[model samples]
Target chain A: MTVIDVRNLRKEYGPHVAVDDVSFSVEHGEIFGILGPNGAGKTTTVECVEGLRRADAGTLEVLGLDPHADGKRLRRRIGIQLQESQIPERLKVWEALDLHSSFYDTPTDWGRLLDDWGLAAKRDTPFAKLSGGQKQRLFIMLALVGSPELVVLDELTTGLDPQARRDTWELIERVRAGGVTVLLVTHFMEEAERLCDRVMVIDAGRVVAVDSPSGLISRAVPEQRVRFRPSAPLDERLLTGLPEVTRVSMTGTRVEVSGNGDLLHAVTSVLARHRIVAADLRVDQPSLDDAFVALTASRPHGSGGSPGASEGASDHRRG
Target chain B: MTALTKYELKLFLRDPAATLIVLVLPVGIVALFGVVMSPGGGDAIETFFPSAAIALGLGQLGMNLLPSTMAGYREKGILRRMAGTPVHPAALLGAQLVVGALFALVSMALVVAVGVVAFGFGPPGSIPAFLLTFVLGVMSLFAVGLLVASIAPSGRVATGIGVAVFFVSIVFGGVFMPVESLPAFIADVGDFTPLGAFMRALRASWAGAWPEPLHLGVMAVVALGFSLLSAKMFRWE
Candidate 1:
């Protein structure tokens, strides 16, 4: 079942069109990702879908309910944790959990959440006293407190240390294992590449590309890179002459051979005959960030719609 | 609804800044007035006590009460946090108003008890008129307080604005001065403001002094209007 369906959604904040004619769908229980650069309309699009922002024009259905007309009801069925919303500075860790848990009708066990989020030790500490990783864990625990079928997480791991980031990733996998659909709004290419089943790269408020991570990388920049440290010297003429070699360009010890079919064997045959034995060889594949840069480089800058004004804007009351 | 009310009360009571602004400051304002002026104008304790209570209530409800309550909630993001909850935002407003009323009543009692015991203050000719003043005073001040909170972007801003308004209303509204003692223009302005009418009606009812009903009615109307507007314009985030 498609839990969320957004068709030709457009959200304009004055001059800049934040989300421009964007369309996408999220299947039930799928870990879908909306990926883009800093100013991409990924957050805006998700906010519109979550019923936080009313699109200038669009039709949105979340969990088979209209986001705008039935916003309150839909919100009750889902869990949302905003990017910058840390619990109040004075609120104790357990107090924060208890307060948030009270907002839902059938809440997850408070004690269970404490243990699950690894916040049991810090239960008595106030929010201001918490470390960055501790605070992030508390937020994640709060987000899952209601046990909703669909969870909307906006930039879940923006500023965590490496170890904390990995722990968060594991927690996300755990949440997915429980059968909850996740709508992740993020700019981290590694996160999208690692966790997202299928990715949507939005640029200038429009869908530029959508597919699995490997699929996107391959589709955008196909072929493996041939790199090797020359044991002696390489004969460029014979290597370039191979039928599978589409392009060959090199400087110093590094050499890039791009082409199709049996290139390893074909290049090896040429090197062996020429008495060039290459050491320290590596076959490189493009990462999600590389594909991300390739995809959004063409988009206009500041497409996220007033990144500066967004901080002070009072319009956050809706979405 | 209960959760919102409880949360508001918890936050209102827990916030160190709000605790001082709403609970301590108003009581301090009242204590200052009691120390500065001698109670009773020779008629009886009834004559002077009610007027003192009115002055103290205004200090509690109007000047100190409204601004800090609203501003504090806005500043703490308590209002914003409550907005997203299953609890209705209306209940949150109601909770603040109730809390203001709660603290105002306690302050009024404390001020009155201290006045009667220390300054030989007494009640008014009619117990009913005095009770009316208390009821009207609480409502009027709560409305004005809501208005202040509605307008302020943060608690600190609200506190600054609230304190300024409180002193102005107290000095010009005749809470500290007799109407005849004020310049005519100042007295006229006082009649229109809720604080002015509250003090006038309260003094008159207590000292066997009587002012036009129009003053009381006008303040009541302003309070009602402000209460509605505050609830309407309030923002959570």
Candidate 2:
């Protein structure tokens, strides 16, 4: 079931178009990602769908109601964690949570949620006093307090260490398991790749590509790269005739075998067959980040060119 | 509307400056100012008591109360945050007015209490006249406070403007100085200003029936216009 659907949405701020003819639908209990660079209108599009902004042109329905026309009802059902979660600087974390909960007809208890978000000890701390991670956690906890049917998280993890990022990812998975539909707007490709069941790559307020991470990568470029550092300089001829090898390139002792799948085994086996020892072997797979870079790089300056323009823009080689 | 009003009243009271100016400060100022104006005699205490009460109400409201409300809210971004909510932004303008009125009412009661307790200050014979004057004085000063907040860019500026306005008005408004001793223009200007009218209305009420309904009526128009203008000009993020 489609929980939310946005079709040909357009919003302009005077002469500048913030969200241009964008369209996508979120399914029941699915994690949907909208990936784009900063100022790419991902947040604007999401805000429009959330009924925070009035669309200049488009049709948007969340939970079977128009986002703008039925905004009051839609707001009650959808929980939004905006790009900037602003709370009063003087307000304590617990106080803010309680105040936000007051707006909803039925809200989750702050006591349990405080512990869940690892903010029990910081209950009395003012909002400005919390660390960045702690603030983000509190912001998310406030968004979830209403037990909303649809959750929208914008740039959920922009600044966090690796471990914190992973923990947030696990929390998101838990949210998904609770049968809540999530629509995420983010600039982090790795986050999109790891979490999104399906993602829409937006550039300058338009959907350039939409598919699973692997699906989009494969669609853009169907090549695998195998890389290895041989004990000494490797001759190009030894790897030139392998069945799986389409292109063999060697930069000093770092040999990169560009071909389809199983090229790594083929290259290693052939090297061994010839008594050529290899070390520090690394396999480079075409990633969502690479595909995104390729698609966005080719797009017209701020106008946001076609999808797949950013492909090959990064140094992506498998070893 | 009433629910929002109640909520605004609660929030406004939470401010330290607001609590001081409205709830506690007015009561204190009235008693303290009453001492300065008190002349010890049979009729001296009664005559001076009403004047001092009116003076305290006017001084605190114009000088220390409403300006702080405007500046504090601007600093906290309270107005901007409220603007985005389902509540009508105009309600906030109304909320500020209600808070001022609350303070005004509290000030009136404190002065009346202190007037009777320390210095026998109540109407000679006419009850209605004295009460009418007290109410009008509050309305006039509250109007002036609103105008100052609307014009001041920040709380500090408002505070400066408020103090200046209060001192000028109290000195010339005939609280301590008689109208006959002042320059004709200064006396005339004081008569026309809300503070002047407030003092006249309160003094007349003590004498008998309110001396001038027109003065009170004009203040109503000014207060209405000032509040409406505040709604139009208030800035929010």
Q: What is the interface RMSD of candidate 2, in Å?
A: 4.4
Over 4 Å off in model 2, which ranges? A124-129, A156-170, A219-225, A240-246, A259-263, A285-287, A302-319, B1-14, B39-104, B119-215, B226-236
lDDT of 1 by residue, B70-117 (tens): 566556655544444445556666766776677766666665565567
In the range B49-135, model 2's lDDT, one tens digit per residue, is 455455655567655577666665665555543433333345665766676677666666666676667655453446777666656
Worst 10-residue lDDT window for candidate 2 chain A reads: A310-319
Give the backbone clash total of model 1. Answer: 11
| TM-score (0 to 1) for chain B of model 2 | 0.78
Give TM per candidate. Answer: 0.85, 0.77
lDDT of 1 by residue, A1-319 (tens): 9999999899888777777778889998888999876666777888787777798897898999998778778777788766565545676878777877777888889898788767898988988899888877887777787778788788888998888888888888888888999988887888888899989987666677788988888766666677777777666777778888888888888787887667777887778877778787777677877677766653444343321112121111111
Q: What is the lDDT of residue B58 in candidate 1?
A: 52
What's the DockQ of model 1?
A: 0.27
Fnat per predicted structure, each in turn: 0.12, 0.00
DockQ of each: 0.27, 0.20
lDDT scores in order: 0.71, 0.71
